[model samples]
Each structure stands twice: as structure tokens, then as C-alpha cells.
Target: MNAPYLLPAMLALAVGTYALRWTGPAMRHRMRLSPRMIHLLDTGALILLAALVATTALPAGTDHLGLALPTGVAVGGVLAWRRVPLLIAILAAAATTALLRLLGVQ
Candidate 1:
């Protein structure tokens, strides 16, 4: 009977996320770094991406993670790693997720 602030909270989150994303490219050219530092930075970026992917692809729960999302991500990752087209990889992941969900998987 008291769910009033959800929309605002979500909008704020969206704004904050976009702000950080936008600043990345805007500040990218302004920053100066050594070649070694640049390589390390690139590695760090990839690590961040991996972490994001993991968190999203794994279903979150209070007690345990679910199997469906992770399975979909695994399929997608392999396809991507094998140099499959991006659209195909994404569609495969989506389809896997949908199928699992349709089967009432947690």
C-alpha cells in the first residue's frame, strides 16, 4: 500500500549510470598514460566487463543463485569466443534464457 518512490529511485539510478558511462568517453582523450599503464588499464576494463557480465548473467537470490541465466551466459560466451556473429550469440543467449524461464526454471 506504500510503493511511491520506486519510479524516482529507478530514474535516479538510470541517470547515475549514464553519467558514469558518458564521462568515460568524454574524459578518455583527456587522460594521459604511459604505454604500460594503458595496457593495464585495458586489462582492468576487461575485468570489469567480465564482472558485470557475471553478475547479470547469474540470477540473484537471497539464498542461492539460479541455473538459468548462467547457462544462457555460458552458451553465449562460448559462441562469442568461437567468433560467432554477435547477433547470433545474443539471440542464442536470449533464447536459452527464454526456454529455461518457460520451463519454470529458477
Candidate 2:
């Protein structure tokens, strides 16, 4: 493997990721989004999050289901529905997942 190339590649990827993230707020400040645009952006973000979750939960060629995805989703849903604090929601999700794994549920 080209070890020397790895650092530069990783740095480039990181910088690109940062640029993409910053593009949103930078553009937002310069150009206010319309209500429709805002709604579209919100939906897009949710879709991206769902895709990320799905990818993590169900990796390619995996036959077994994992508890992490379902537990995270459940916790997130509960938090949203109950209007729970963000920190508590995160902790609850992490703890629940850990406990489930410890008990060998998945």
C-alpha cells in the first residue's frame, strides 16, 4: 500500500467534506431560502440520514438484522414525539443499544 499517499488522500477527503458542509450555511447567509426550498432541504436531510442509518444497519451481503438501527430509530422517534432533551435522547439511545447488546438480543 502507498502509505505516504494515504495522509494526503485523507486530508483531501476531510477538506472536501468540510467544504460541502460549509456550503450550506455560507449560501444560506447570502441567499435566503424560500419556504418551499426550506421544506425540500429538510426532507433531503432526513432522507440522507435515513440512508446513512440503513447503510449502517444493513451492510451489503448481511443476512442478520442488527439492533443498533432499530434501537436508534426507536429512541429518536420517542424523543421527537415526547420532545425529550437532546442529550437525554442520545444517552438513552446509546444506553439502550449497549444494554441490548450486553443481553445478546442481537
Candidate 3:
């Protein structure tokens, strides 16, 4: 937290982050991932995404899970699955959540 060290530390982190971001595209051509590895990576990404959605839709450490958030998320998911426009789906989800909250659904 010292003033003198803060800038240098930030610069180091910035450079390191940029290098990591650059390395992926830089090495993509040379990296030969096996089919199984590629499949695992794809599956892992989906699992991670689902986990993120679940956590956000139903927050942790709450006394009880509320209906509004999960219902809104389900609405969004269904719309997305049905190939609805992303913006419309997101707005619909937000609207659903707000409406449910306003109606005292908690």
C-alpha cells in the first residue's frame, strides 16, 4: 500500500496480464491439443458457466432461496435457448425480476 511501491507493482501486474493474454493467441498455432483434451475444455467451459449461473441465480448463505431470481434466470435461459435476441432476453429477464420483486414475491 506504500505509494512508492504501488505504481511498480501495478506496472508489473499489468505487463504480466498482457503477456498472458498475448500468449494464448501467440501460441495457438503451435499448440496441438488432442481431440479429447479439446472436448474436455469445451465441457469444462460449459460446466463453469452453469455453475456461475447457478450461484448468481441462487445466492449462497441465505436463509431461504427466493423465487424471483431463479424464475428470472429460467426465463432468460428459455429465451436464450429459443434463439431470442440477446438484448431482448436480458431485458425480459430484468423486467421479470423487477416485476416479481415489486409484486412482493421476494
Candidate 4:
């Protein structure tokens, strides 16, 4: 929310996206993973994905959001786990958060 930080944040995000796009193909020729290694990599990716979500949902430091984020995340996670389409799951989560906030939930 800091105006002065926006450019730096956007630049960082762009760099991160660029890195993610480039890293796999860039290193692909350097190593070949075994099946077990592939599985572990997949699992590690999933864990990192979850960790990112958790951090966003339950933020630390100064600008504290609230429990509504995590509650909505749980709803979204259940829908996703039940094989709901990605868009629907995301909308459901957003709706949940909005409704909770409207109802004065912290």
C-alpha cells in the first residue's frame, strides 16, 4: 500500500515471473531426474504452493488482514480438492471472503 514501493514491488514480481519461466528450460539439459526425483520435485512444488497461499491468507508483519482470508482459503481448498474447476474455486473463495467481511467478521 506504500506508494513509493509500488515500482520496486512490480519489478520484483516481473523478475520472479521471468525467473520461473526461464529456470526450468535453462537447467533442463544440466540434469535428468529419476522417477522418484520427479515425484519429490512435484511434492516439493505443491508444498511451496501451499506455503505461498498460507502466507498470503495469514499475513504477518504490519498490515494484518484477518481470519476471513484463511476461512475463505479453506473453502476454496475443499472445492479444489473435490475437483471443482479453478475459476469456480477462486470465485467461491473470493465470495466467501467478501461475504464474511460484509458480515463484520474479522
Candidate 5:
């Protein structure tokens, strides 16, 4: 937390992160992933993304989950799955959330 150590710490972290990012591409040609491993990784990514969405959409400090946020997210997800433009999907989600809230659906 000291001011003097902050710069050095940040630099070290940045270098480490860069090295990690570079490692994957640098080793990609040398390393081979099995089909099962690839499938697992894809599934893991989807699961993580879903978890992030759930946590972000769920209301805080509440005993019961609200319908508006999840409904909006579902609408966005459906649009995205149908290959709709990202901006439109996002705007539709926001509009859905606003309308639900205005209708006192929380």
C-alpha cells in the first residue's frame, strides 16, 4: 500500500500478465489439445459466462429474485442467439428491463 512500492508492483504485475498472454500464442504451435480438452474448455467458458450473467443480473439485498433483470437478460440472449446486431440486442434488453420496472414487475 505504500506509494513507493505501488509503481514497482504495478509494473511487475503488468509484465507478468503480458508474459502469460504471450505464452499461449507462443506455445500454440508446439502444444496440442485433445478434442475432449477443447470441449471442456468451451463448456467451462460458457459456464463461467453464465455464472457472471446470473450474478450481475440478480438484485442485491433481496430475499426474492426479481423477474425484470433475468427476463431482460433472456431476451438479449435470445436476440444474440438469433444473430441479431449486438447494439440492438443490448438496447432491447435495456428497454425490456425499463419497461418491466415501470410496470412494477420487480
Candidate 6:
């Protein structure tokens, strides 16, 4: 938590994250992705994104579910159902989250 240590820690984290992201692309030429491998990678990415959303919106040791879960659900539903624009999907999720929070659903 020290100021000096913070920079090093952040740098390491960034590098590690970058490496993980680059792993698939880096191996693209060397490896062919089987259907199962492709599915697994896609699932892994979605799970990681869900975890990030949960952490940011729900946090830890909190009873409130907040706007994250519902927003993610809405966005997923829209993506699955229709060929909507990315911006529209994002806006819909944000709007839904705001409405849910305003209604005291958390």
C-alpha cells in the first residue's frame, strides 16, 4: 500500500493482465482453436467480465445487489435477442441500472 510500492504493483498487474489477454492472439498462428477451445475461451472471457462487474457494482461483504447484476442481465438479454447497436445496448443497460437503483431494488 506504500506509495512507492503502488507503482510497481500496478505495473506488474498491468503486465500480467496484458500477457493473459495477448496469450490467445500470440498463439493464433502457432495453434489452431478447436470448437471446444474457442467456446472455452469465450466462456472464460465472459466469466471474467461478469466477475469484474460484480466486484465494481456489488463489492464485498455487502447485502445490496446494486445495479451491476441487473444491468449485465439486461445487456446479455439484448445481445442474445437482437442485432442491436453496441451503443444502444450500453445505453439500455445504463438506463436499466439507473431505473433499478432509483426504485430501491438493491
Question: Could you give candidate 2's per-residue lDDT for residues 1-106 as a string of tens digits?
Answer: 4999999999999999999999988897688779999899888966765675556545677687787657765675466446688678778777777888888877
> CA lDDT of 50 in candidate 5?
69
TM-scores vs. true structure, each candidate: 0.48, 0.58, 0.69, 0.55, 0.65, 0.49
In order, candidate lDDTs are 0.82, 0.74, 0.85, 0.84, 0.85, 0.70
Q: How many backbone collisions does model 4 have?
A: 0
The model with the greatest TM-score is 3
Pairs of residues clashing in candidate 2 = none
Candidate 3 Cα misplacement greater than 4 A, ranges: 74-96, 102-104
TM-score ranking, best first: 3, 5, 2, 4, 6, 1
lDDT of 1 by residue, 75-100 (tens): 88778666789799889988998899
Pairs of residues at least 3 apart in sequence or in different chains that clash in candidate 5: none
lDDT of 6 by residue, 1-88 (tens): 7899999999999999999999978898997779999899888967776675446545567776666556655574556346567577
Clashing pairs for model 6 are: none
Please give the TM-score that candidate 2 achieves against the real structure. Answer: 0.58
The superposed Cα distance between candidate 3 and the true structure at residue 95, in angstroms, equals 5.0
Q: Identify the superior model by lDDT, candidate 2 or candidate 5.
A: 5
Note the clash tally of each candidate. Answer: 0, 0, 0, 0, 0, 0
lDDT: the better of candidates 3 and 6: 3
- Which residue pairs overlap in candidate 4's backbone? none
RMSD of each: 5.7, 4.0, 3.5, 6.1, 3.6, 5.2
